[model samples]
Target: MAVIKAEAYGHGMLRVAESLAPRVDALAVSCLDEAAALREAGHHQPILALQGFKDERDLRAASQLDVAVTVHEDSQLRLLAATRLHRPVRVWLKLDTGMGRLGFAPSRAAELVAALTSDPNVTAVPGLMTHLACADAPERPENAAQLARFEAATRHLPGERSLANSAAILALPDAHADWVRPGIMLYGGSPLADQSAAGLGLRPVMTLSTRLIAIHALAPGEAVGYGATWRSERPTRVGVAAIGYADGYPRHAPNGTPVLVRGQRVPLIGRVSMDMITLDLTDLETVQVGDVVTLWGEGLPVDEVAAAARTISYDLLCRVHDRVQVVTG
Candidate 1:
């Protein structure tokens, strides 16, 4: 399943779903609303709501939409066991192997599986699934441990099983049970902290570019941007680019974070403001107003920018606001 939750990690969910419909066997979303949006947009592929329904109303809507749901907790299970829908709803029994977030206890897997398989409202035997907490860190024991627990719990279960996430898809082949959930990888972000996307042979699918609107020649003592956080150490040419936190550029990005100007890397020299950022263009003498500046993507990796900002690539990608115009190629 191609996990395109959170608007495909802010890369535009509907478009991504449209593009992946012919390629993937199924799609996964965080909730019913996302699945409903895809259905309304005319997509007929299978969609799994990862968070499942909150109440009977949501369960009824899921049934109406023919959306599969994750039965992770007792409340959802209770609701599913008691409600009688017009049609059976496909269910995936999520086991809490080690993720600690969602899922029922692994020890109850046998009881739940038996109950779900016999339940009149359930479409078929419930598919067993689990979330891995440390798939990105291959050296961590949690991945193997989770896989072991999952296998021990559902080794003889009838329905299909799903365990691998984006990180596991790249790192743990053993965890790729029956369905592999690819989220960040589908958007071209590296799931491993120690690896780069390019190194992992994953090219960025989105590029965020802005234009340099103004330039300034600053003297040694002149300070730049809000709070005067950065000052010129010598003769400096500062290029002001038209993007900032309001547009989803990290405000916490410190001086020296790289920005691409004319495809050349230059250090961001001051505090990232609400509307713009200042870049040190002292070496790029030919840079001028209206020159293209890449915030992150293509020549500049979002991971690098995210690292300098002390966050993850996921945060940077999802935080991109509506103000930023999206141009798909």
Candidate 2:
């Protein structure tokens, strides 16, 4: 399954779903609305709601929409038992394994699987899935421990099993079961902390580019932007790009963050404001107003920008504001 949740990590969900539908066996989303949106958009492939239904109405809607959902908690199980649907709703029984977030205890896998398998409202033999907490850091012992727990619990079960996210899909070949949930990797972001997307052979699907709207020559003693956090150490030509936190650029991104200007690398200066980020274009003497500036993507990787901002690429991708125009090639 291709995990297109969070608007395909802000690359546009419906478009991503439509694009991946022909290649993937199934598409996974975080909620019923996403699944419904795909179905309403004429996507006929299987859709899985990773978070599952919130209430009986949601469950009923899932059933009616033919969207499968994860069954992780007792409340969801209870809801399933009490509700009568026109058709049986498919379910994936999530095991806690070691994530400690959602999922039932692994020890109860047999009992819960039995319950779901026998329940009239549920499809027979629910799929099994577990999230890995340390798959990104392949050296961590938790990855093996979670896999061991998941294997012990579902090895004898009858349904299809899914255990690999983007990290595990690349690092843990053994964990690649019947279904592999490729999330970040699908959007061309590296899931492994030590690896770059290029090293993983993943091409970025989104490029956030904007124009340099203004340029200012700052004297050595002058400070720029909000808070006056950064002052020119020397005579500096600051190029202001028409992109900032309002466009989903990281506000916390410190000075010296890398941005591409006229195919040359420039250091961002001053605090990232709501609608603009100032860049040190001192070295790029030819840079002028209206020159294209790449925030992240193409010449620059989102992972590198995320690292400078002390965040993950996933956070940056999903935080892109809807106000930013999306131009698909």
Taking every candidate in turn, the Cα RMSD to the unseen true structure, in Å, is: 0.9, 0.7
Deviating ranges (above 4 Å) for candidate 1: none
Error of 1 at 137 (Å): 0.7
lDDT for model 2: 0.93
lDDT of 2 by residue, 1-329 (tens): 99999999999999998789889999999999988999999998899999999999899999999999999999998999898898999999999999999999999999999999999999788999999999999999999999899889887889999999999999899889999999999988999989999999999999999999999899998999999999998998988899889889999999899999988899998999999999999998698899999988897999999999999999999999999998988
Off by over 4 Å in 2: none
Cα-based lDDT for every prediction: 0.92, 0.93
TM-score of each: 0.98, 0.99
Which 10-residue span in candidate 1 carries the lowest summed lDDT?
A: 150-159
Deviation in angstroms for 329 in model 1? 1.1
Score candidate 2 by TM-score against the native.
0.99
Reference-based lDDT, residue 232, model 1: 89
- Candidate 1 lDDT by residue in tens digits, 172-213: 889887899999888778999799999999989989999999
TM-score of 1: 0.98
